[model samples]
Target: MTRQELRHKLQQVRRNLPAEQQLAAAFQVADKLEQRLESFVPQETTVAVYKSFAGELPTSPIIERLWQLGFKTVLPVLHPFAKGHLLFLSYTSKTPMTINKYGIEEPELNAQNVMPLSEVQVLLMPLVGFDHQGNRLGMGGGYYDRTLAQWHNGNRPNLSPIGLSYNEQQVESIPVESWDIPLPEIITPAKHWRF
Candidate 1:
């Protein structure tokens, strides 16, 4: 199936899941996140992750776990002036939030809370679909693709972007565009995939 076709199908599958199942999956994902990430990241490392929406894998539990483990966590905010880009902002349970154009909850823009991509150790990228090779299919706007274009081009290799996917979202292959950046790793509820 085409990327769009796959997106429609997988999105339906996720939305159809019972509320209890979604909760269970989120817990499993959070547990797995702690196990996989704690071994590699340093104490001062900061993580960039998105706020889950539209039946995407839940991220709140993982965010809480990261905080408990003493890792700084940030959420993406649509750049106020830069079109088609994102800026990572410090996110905490107490951080003030507002709905963006996409209707996704994001931290209210604050200059003092901004964290540059170069300083971020890992980005827990959200995707509609992914392949074992780490190819990702996003919501078609290419916000992340554009934001990480420099990193994809090897300009600043320090920024690492990895996907957070559920087991059912995996496809055999993801039709990728020339500018698409394939993930180096992806973490799911059941297992972690490294490309």
Candidate 2:
């Protein structure tokens, strides 16, 4: 199937999940991630994550767990000046949030609150679909593809890009474009996938 068709199919599959199942999956993913956190990042390292939207896997539980575990967390904000790019901002329980053009909630932009890419150790990203080969199909905006292009090109050796999704989002194969970046790892309620 085509990329757009696959995205629609997987997105609907996830969106159809019961609320209780979504909650269980969120907590399950959080627990699995906590068990493997130390292997990727050191103590107190900054971990960048996205706020779940649409039928995406719920990340609130994971975010709360990270806060309780003392890991510094950051969230992606649409870059104000750079079109199609994302800026990571310091996210906490108290960070003021605003809706972006896409209607997704993000931490309010503040220059001082921006976390440089050099300071980000792990980036937990959301996706519409992912495959066993680690290829990720995003919401078609290419925000993450543009943001992590450098990392995929071996420029950001210190950065770890991980995708978060539900098991149902997995596809047999994804039609990849030249600029698509495959994630090194992805975590789901069922299993942790390492590519």
Candidate 3:
């Protein structure tokens, strides 16, 4: 299937999941991540994650657990002047919130709170779909594509981009673009896929 067609299909399945199942899956995902994340990231390392939207795997529980476990967390903000790019900002329970133009929730942008992607150890990203090869199908705006281009090109060695999705989002193949950025690891409620 084409990229857009596959995205719509997988997203529909995600939205159709029962609320109870969604909650259960979210919890299970948080547990699995918590168990594995510490082995790679050290104490107080900053993890960049997104605020879940639509039928994307819920990340609120995971964010709370991150704080409880003493890991600093960050969220992506739409870059004001840089179109099709993202900026990572410090995120906390008390961080001021705002809705971006795309209607995604993000911590309000503040220059002082902005973090260079180099400093973030792990980035937990949301996706429409992913494949076993770590190819990610995103929402198609290319925000992450532009932001991660450097890392994908072998510039950011310290940066680890991880996709967070539901098991249902996994597919046999994902249409990839030259500019597409593939993830190194992805975690679902069922298990982790390392590429």
Candidate 4:
């Protein structure tokens, strides 16, 4: 099937999922991802993560676990004045948060931008779907693609990009653009596939 066709089918699957089932599936996927992530001893101290939103794979539990394990966690902050640009915000339980234009919860702008993507040890990326080759299909905003491209051009950080998704979202292939970033690893409810 074509990329558009697969995207449509994935959307239909998403729409068919009831709220309870979605949450249940997300929890299962999260469990599997956390287990795999536990084995890696990160070279970079700080990690980047996204705050979960509608129909996306949830990461809050995993973030909390990482925090408990003494890892510094940062959440992505979308520039309030710009489109497709991102800033990293150090996150803690007390850090203030607000909804962005996309309606996703994010850290407050007041949070200091400590370091760039190069400083990040790991990035737990959220995706709508993924294929075995680690190609991620995002929500079409391309914020992640742009940010990753920038990082790749600069003193590229030793960061590992990992995609989280449910097994149902896996496909044989996904459309890739010139600027699209490929994930090195993808973790689903059933297993982890590394490229």
Candidate 5:
């Protein structure tokens, strides 16, 4: 099926999920991700993670676990004009937060901007849907695609990019744009798809 058709089918599946089942799926997916990530003891001091919202894959538990493991966790700060230029801010349970234009919670702007993407060891990317090849369909903001493109152009150090999603959101294929970023690993409740 085409990208739009696949997106439509995934939307139907999402709509059919009851609230309880949705939560269960999120928890299950998180468990799988946590297990895999746990094995790769992050060597880079700073890691980037996205905060979960709406139908996005959940990562709160993983974030908490990373914190306890002494890995410095950072989150994306959305830019007004840029589709995917994000400022990384240190994250803590008590860090002051504010909702951005997208209604996603983010760390306070005053937080210091540290090293760029090269300094980040791993990125736990969130997605609305993904395919076997690790092509991700986001919430249509294009922010992640843009940010990843910039990171690549800068020739930053190798940072593992992983997409998180529920099993129901997986598709056979997703249309790729010229600027779209491909993930190395795609993790879901049922299994992990590596590209």
Candidate 6:
């Protein structure tokens, strides 16, 4: 199947999951996150993450876990000036929110809350599908592809880009494009895959 077709299929599967399964997956991924990342990331370091939407793996638990562990959490905000790019904004329970064009909730733009990519130690990305080889299939907007291209090109050597997925999103193989950046790690309800 084509990438677009696969995206639709996986998305539908996730959307159709029972509420109990979704809650279970949320906590499971958070547990794996704390087990795998807590040792490597220092307290107060900025970690970039996203607001889960469209039946994606829930991230509220993960974000709360980071807070409980004393790690700084940031969420992606649509870059007001950069057409298709994204900017990271410091996210907290009190952070103001706004719905973007795509109807996804994001942290309201605030200059003081913006976190630079260089300062981010880990980026927890949302993906539609992935393979054993770590190839990720995003929502086809290329938002993350553009962001990770800098890291792939060696601009941000210390950045650890990790994908958060569900077991149902796994596929046999994904045809890669020139700009596609395979993740170094991905955490799911079932396993923590490293490449």
The order of the candidates by lDDT, greatest first, is 6, 2, 3, 1, 4, 5
**lDDT against the true structure, each candidate:** 0.85, 0.90, 0.87, 0.76, 0.75, 0.91
Model 6's TM-score against the true structure: 0.97
Question: How well does model 1 score by local distance difference test?
Answer: 0.85
Whose lDDT is higher: candidate 2's or candidate 5's? Answer: 2
Q: Model 2 over residues 45-155: C-alpha lDDT tens digits?
A: 899988989978899999999888888999999999999999999999999999999989999999999998888988899889988899999999999998789797777
The residue-by-residue lDDT of candidate 3 on 1-195, one tens digit each, is: 889899899999999999888888888888988887767644658899889899989888888888888898899999999877899999988999999998999988899999988888888888899988999998999988886887877778877788888899999999888888788899899998888
Give candidate 5 regions above 4 Å deviation. Answer: 1-12, 39-44, 80-84, 111-115, 151-154
Model 1 RMSD in Å is 1.4
Error (Å) of candidate 6 at residue 89 is 0.5
lDDT per residue for candidate 5 within 3-87, as digits (tens), equals 6677667767776778777667666766776666675665446778888877565677678767776778889888645555787
What TM-score, to 2 decimals, does candidate 3 have? 0.95
Model 6 alpha-carbon drift over 4 Å, by segment: none
Between candidates 4 and 5, the one scoring higher on TM-score is 4
As for TM-score, the candidate ahead, 1 or 2, is 2
- The prediction achieving the highest TM-score against the true structure is 6
Q: What's the residue-level lDDT of 92 in candidate 4?
A: 83
- In candidate 5 the C-alpha lDDT for residue 64 amounts to 72
lDDT per residue for candidate 4 within 78-167, as digits (tens), equals: 876677788888888998888888899988887355456777877788888888788888878888887777656655657777787777
Q: Which ten-residue region of model 4 has the weakest summed lDDT? A: 35-44
Give the Å error, residue 135, model 5: 1.3
Better of 1 and 5 by lDDT: 1
Candidate with the greatest lDDT versus the true structure: 6
